[model samples]
Target: VGAALAAAPGADEAYGGFVYIMWGEKANCLSQVAHRNLETLLSAAPNARYRFFLYGPAQAAGYRIADGLSKVQFQRYAKRGYDVHMRLVNARWGPYAPATGVRDAWADQTNVGEDWPGEDRPGEAWWYAHRSRFPYEDKKHSKLKSVQPHPRDAFFNAVVHMYLTGGVHTDLTVAFSGLEKLTTGAEAQYAMYGDGCERRDAAYDDIITEFDGWDVSLPMALYFPDAGHPALKCVLDKYDQAVQNLSGLDAMERYCLTPQAPNGFPFYHEEEPHEGDYEAPPPAGMAQLRPGHGACARYLLETCKAQTELQDPAAPALKAMTVEWMGCDAGFHWDQWRFPYAASKPFRELAAPEGFDAAGVTGVWTGAALHGKRWEEPPEEHFISKEIYRAHPATRWDHPALKAGLLARQWQRENAIADVEDADRVFAEDPDFPKCAAALPACTSFFHDFSELKDMQYYREDAPKSPRNAAAARCSPTLIIPGAEKGASTFLYSLLAEHPQMISPLKGAGFKETGAYLAGFDRPGQLWDKTSHFPLIRENEPFLTGDATVINMVDKGAAKRVVRDNPNPKVIFSLRNPTDRLWSAYRFTFNVYYKTHLPDLSYANIVNDSVDGFGQCMQRQLSGAAAAAAGAAGEDAGDAEIE
Candidate 1:
């Protein structure tokens, strides 16, 4: 036996090494067997090392030692230098306790207000801390009869049965003996164990002597206990029958539920066949050859065929083959007769030429009058009456030519023009104007107000410049005004465009081309670059990112000069009301594009969806904004501010 134990793998290690043994409650019989095996092994290899780590129902076996037996057999072995160390390892009954705390923590963070009870639960903290931890157990153990296990002890008994048999290993079992005592107490006259302790002692003696140092790990069939413990044996038999029944049922279900082709017959009951099949009677308006079996009248048959053709030409064509094969003298042959097909016709075609003449038809014309009759007459009363125009000569300048002359006179008064004659001389001397004049109609006025044109030149001479470019060129530089959406920034851009040294996209091609050249992308092509090139540094502002290289503009001198050279260099960050902005965001997210291009989400869904769902989407937007801003600032600031 010692030689066999030495040959066993994992047996030659140090004495008292940890050994974890686990078995369920229903496996109580294994406890004695395991103990017997351990004793055998220790006897064979007295110096072998091991510690017993008992878990599940196996732990209960350690508690089962009789008081007398512990002092005698068990304690004697311990004192006899047998190396056996036993310990209990805890088993989880349910999910971890920290998981429940995590759920409560989330609930606390999402609290809203008084309108929602689940969110604003001021009482929940105490309740969760004290009571919510074990709701199922509390309900089960409650004293009130109405609350007791829902339907008395039967429910709890079933729950226990499920816990025992449903793949859960626990250290407790309600055996037949225990249940009999619970149900009938001391009243029922049934022995707790069949054949009593004497029979059990005899059976144990026989089994122990024949154990023969057999390896417990070897596969061996388990047998039901003999009649000495009929109650335990009966329970084992019942469990075996249940397992066999389940396997048989599974096989039967697989066989019975296999799909079969549907029966060809329709679902309804079949009609009984007649001994001699009866023929259907001829339809109405037919001439009877035999009173009930008659040939359809020629007109009726023809009319039906024609109606069928009108409904579906193919149906008549298919019916034609059958009709011709029958060879009945019924004059209903296809194409033999024509049916009057009714359709709407134009009524005017039937009318005489003289009737159309009497209807007074006329051809389309572009002339001001038809048949030499005037359509529009000169106004008898003008919007500016002659007396009013004469009374206020300045107001008569509403006429283009008169307005130009008046503007010239005003310019002369302001000393912006040398004289009215000088204004006329400039207009006449302008090479561009004469080229434009040739294209005008001979009768139309060409001379117009030049005052606006003159004022434009004056403002153009005062524009700002970019300090970086000015320093590079050793001269005052031009400021660049970027375009933005409807906001103070846009207004500032427009205002800055009026300066002579300030180059803006709003200006002519020269300035626009220059800015585009410096940026290395076309003016319109770099629309997306606006975010990075002109980032919004303020909260609630839209951060732009047009392209990659815009960060180079953030240097100290460049940043200051970009701001200082322009008429209004300070960046104006415009923010609308929060509600309005939220609404706009909802619209843009759900509706701005064509139906197919738009997202499937509705505005209400966006506003009323879960906070986590909305938070996730906003988190993405915030991240994108942070990236854009970081790119512009040439720094790695994350989405902290946006979040």
Candidate 2:
């Protein structure tokens, strides 16, 4: 963690901009004393940097249940308008824990007032463990009951994600979870593992494993009795006997579970030592599981006048901090029960002033989640997803211009200047307006991270000496390698990106294929801000910059937008025989989707869809200079027609 911060440009200097956000799933924050020790260094180095993106939105993001603040408090927080960065989401289900949160499972942090979510912490993930092996008399595990991907709820999460962003994710994250593995006694810690317990054979006698997703570095720790023990193996075999699908999960659990203790008692769950500073172990009653009920609600309230001055000066900068009774996935988190649906309720139905009507929220996919439908091709179904660009040509903007778009709108709105020609005019013309001798250089970008830059203040003429916002007229990408899907675009780009000089999005393919030129126009600055997007490098030092948005290859207007935004853009297109490319892409695309969301979709359906114009998605743009003339003609035509 310290290494990452040290690598940030100028982080070692008198005015470092690195902001470390200490967070985890539950309220496992350090004690006031520990928090203060870290706070002292940050407080003393005021210019070095100071900030923390509070983990307050865990409930709001459907990642947890409501543990902090009441419905009123939550609604008020949403109304207060906190910033949310949306990006490519490839969500899968499973119960896993963040590393920092490991200690939280032993004890909790939020113990302020009477209103706090009690010891169980129904909204946090750690407290959800009780729901795994045991259920209350009334309710049971939802994911275990459904046994299917909650794509629809995910769509709502995605839509909420879009609503939070100005309609597009800053970048994309194609991370897939579901990576789980079983381990024997060879793993890292034994029973005496940091849980404040004395060295004991109990920890070493069990089989402990991990279930993690996305970042392999982070995984959920799952502890079980030693599977090799004969007595324990007998109970596991019982579960193995009851499970019907012998070859599937049944076999998996059969080999994995300990089922019970060696002494023939039911499986026992242990909490870490909870004594002061964890020097002592938890007492009998304190460590045992208890059942209880919880209720929480959220309503997206229109941000009143609380928006930051620099966000969208026109429309209130959208911010929602809230979720519903969406099923809680297995590995067990009582706190996460029905998180998706429960927390998302507020985003769908925004709160209103007293006596006024509330905004009835609609899923981004509308009834798509409830309805049996999947986007097969073109006219992209999701707004931020491709089709919205085809529906409206003027919606696009390159990254640099996208950043400027917000400032342009702000300038235009404040000046009341309706003239199109003056759209680029700077509005801070007053003699008393603050000014700097020279414009600061843009921070070309070091990695996908949030720097000290806050809001549009970094876009002014007298921007900081070393750019706070990267002054991003020229998005860091110095090269472009649009592709013909089946062609070796992946192979070609990978080889190029490996060079020390080349820099790409950490989310590689996700950021590359984003047809932003078609959606970036009029997009908010957050769309390009560190909060929304990530850079691939470390420190501002750069040798080459570029991206490989293969989709841009098919969307002719996309290439045009890129060139128009930065005339010197280095562009390359990987070519191959149409037949070979299509054939390869068809098989590859079918297999990928099948493994992902389309288990029910057959190879025949994939072939049929490809034949019926779905393949149009693979074409590498319309050729010729006419297409490259750019959006000028099309945008003008729309403007003329409108006038």
Candidate 3:
């Protein structure tokens, strides 16, 4: 399958590429789940590229990269010699399909053959090879082309996005990590497809009964080794067919035995006006589509068949894994712990798929598991219900095995267990056993469970009152004075410090400047020690600390750093008459500091030589200001000199 997908020998370049898609403004509660899941994945695959395909405004969705992953986590990863990089892409631009405002090609073509052209039939191999155009016509199904809409329409854009920007397209809820081997596909197909449902075990017969009638065959997560895979195109084609109700056409004409196969003939066909002459159907595998509903599954099967000849070398043969959370499979409804479906099942049951190598199951795409509650889901969809616990008294959160699994999962997350090897150990080991189980009785929801498992000893160790961290917590500047150098910033800082409510950094032999922000603390190993700069204040004191770094105003990064680090810092910028400030600066630098070097030239001589240059600079500054004002008022400042 790897050879069939056309992957180069020993090049696992695509293994680290991951794709995450969100269509519209997702709620914060739901977005947090995605954030947590992404962070979890990064813990395991620290160097992987997490590409977010956001269809709508990311800010509106509260999906900022910094907001999702904490600064401390980034620092931790960076310290480990790994850069956790996430690439956010605007999914609306370029060759990508729009989520809205496209012609509803599926609207009027409810009856398959009536509107579909004979050449557009999906079964015909010619269309796959030649592909003149997408099957749908541009003509409006209704008078208004955009009138009718489907829930799956925007999701279809997700399919298009996966094709355009290939990688592993994952649902936000799915978490688990470490699937380098299967992903690189050193032994098997480049593409992999798996079920969203848990692996079927006879032991789970009673517990999994809630979803007995629900169709769980459709894969929640999809993997394609490369972008523009022909199989994905086939998936898109089938999706178009599904939207138009044309996907069932081949099955519709199966009994009729049409000589032309599914060559877009009408569903009902007769040889000679009721004289029943039997014709052979298409071959067995081609006769019945594998997924029945899932376009990807069907098309991948088709693409594999088409690749029997060497002409299409890129045709993907899918490696179908058993329906289990083999690490990479999504835990579909796992977080609906209150629901009957999840409450009865233990996490360990899903953690280790029976008979499989513990290491082989690398990642698990927990499909909408965290956020797929009724309220979060579409109105038409119902994933899990909170009332299930109320309805089923037998299914309780404190069930020993279920509680144990939940506790283990929590421990894995709390400890930042990056490797599956360590994660699996939680099932057998009870690092926080007594404490974790003691808190289980109080657990009301999935998020609240295993609260005690979190080692708060770290928090205790760095208590704000502790000598080392006291000033760090208290002295983080509430005020910053990034000065206009040579501006009377020092005098202003002195005056502010004199106020009973205000405090400046402990004045020493040096200037009242920390110079911390000037030297950027953006990257790892760059430390900003507030303690070294400011004196620790008493617990009862009502005082605000400040860093009056004079050069900070001119430092390009200082102001930005100040804003980023502080919550509501009051910035004081001291301004002075430009000419006067320049002269003061000149006197300070040339006469005071570098006076010995220029022994031959007196201050008067230096001033006399620099007057003309200073005058020109001042004139240019004034002229540029005038020009800017004039431009704002729609007037031209002719021959204005810009500084």
Candidate 4:
């Protein structure tokens, strides 16, 4: 805490300050410590702006306390000089994903006092009995007290229920921790991620659900499902999209074929295409073509009908077509475009006089822009690359055209090479990431699921587990993560275990803490070897391995034995305020020991008297043999605080 204060202010221009916290034993306790740490730091440090994102009851505690105390007291925190720009309460606890019928009692946030003033218990209680009938539940859960249409009206109601309403709205900076929930496999892929019409538009939706988290470093990662920054906007365009129409293409990319694979062509048209007119016997050109993708696109182009011709564009005939999102083709170049079949023009007059069977059979050499009064001439130069013309068996090419064709082909090869470089970079940096990216409930499409599977395979092939790690376990003494009681050893353990580079007791040994030093294993090496308990190697890199047992610092003999066995071993120690640690230990121990092991001890007596010899060697106090003699003679030599 002192160190961070001593250091000059850090910088994140977007969101000013970080609200750091550690979840503890009791949800209440965890929030308590986290709140204290956050409040202490913000009060001391000076910063340009602060964006406070709080979670659970601790956040509401302020609002609850303020409402319980007085409105003026609550306003005081916001009145401070610093810019507390945003206060978003992500008020979720218990399972991140729950069944449709289920409801969390704590999550049912309401302030009945606001409606039935001074009634305190009775009037509000009466309102609560019939509140479900009125629209009061709507304002109770909505930010700014407004209703937004939602899909699955029941789910919309569920979202409304998660709102935090206990606190009085502070300043403009205050925001509701809106509900946006979607686990990986819980719902249909498109339902939770499509354009605005899908109601799964993450860009517009609040509350995102991710179980294992993702490798955000991947290019265009956020644009995909389950991996994106909170600030990222999803669902660029809104329409009742026919998602199932492209299922086959989606499957191909997801499973055996990768999205980036050259063989699996993307749906969107490229910047340029080879041109060949259907004049004479037949024009021939070797160029890849990706025409209208879905049924709607094909129908519109085939019918030569304008956007107005379709009374309802989402008709079955048009819904299955593939097309671009939206664009402007004012320059006569095909570059200006729009998609979803509904948006693009499909008139025969816009293309050719003999539209359907024209050059290349149903090709549109020209088209009208959405706003333009008249049709524009085909921008032949833009669409027809010299490379396409050259590819034809019979061609009278100009020197300039031939040179340009060759240059374009060379550029393509260079781009392909650059793509390889990027793939390699991703592999080298996060090669083994896929092994753990297995989302709970599992992703549906092979393209999305197999994306990580392929990466995992590549990592395993490139970096096999080391045999030496098995050997290291036989002789190497375990690294220790000792604790100052209540210093978040469990929280730290879980975080470290998530890292590929670190191995904890759960990974190496069977249990989280072996307790071998205190237990006095006959042959610790043999037992460890027999169990094959070792930190497994990953990616040809050694892991930082250790076990956590908070008692080690006070266990003098345990430390001595570890030094004797392994001359050099790392030790991690975490500390907290003595009084705070005692309080936390009280909470933990009182629950476990009060009725069972320490029936004789009161909470206060335990906290005050037990602090002295809790982690000390009582024998050392009397300086060895003389004390040993006193102990042997039938005297009460051990410290009363010790036992």
Instruction: Specify the highest-lDDT model's number.
Output: 3
**TM-score, every prediction:** 0.15, 0.28, 0.34, 0.24
How would you encode candidate 2's per-residue C-alpha lDDT over 127-205 as one tens digit per residue?
2322232221122222222111121112122222222211111000100011011111122111100122122222212
Tell me which of candidates 2 and 4 scores higher on TM-score.
Answer: 2
- Candidates arranged by lDDT, highest first: 3, 2, 4, 1
- Candidates 2 and 3 compared: the better one by TM-score is 3
Question: How many residue pairs clash in all the candidates, one count each?
Answer: 22, 35, 10, 22
lDDT (Cα atoms) of all candidates against the true structure: 0.24, 0.27, 0.39, 0.27
Top TM-score: which candidate number?
3
Answer with 1 or 3, whichever has the higher TM-score: 3
* Candidate 2 lDDT score at position 297: 5
Candidate 1 stretches greater than 4 Å from native = 1-503, 506-568, 582-599, 605-643
Model 3: runs farther than 4 Å from truth? 1-18, 21-26, 30-36, 43-48, 57-151, 186-219, 240-314, 321-323, 326-357, 365-643
Q: In lDDT terms, how accurate is model 1?
A: 0.24
Which candidate, 1 or 4, would have the higher lDDT against the true structure?
4
User: Could you give me the TM-score of model 2 versus the true structure?
Assistant: 0.28
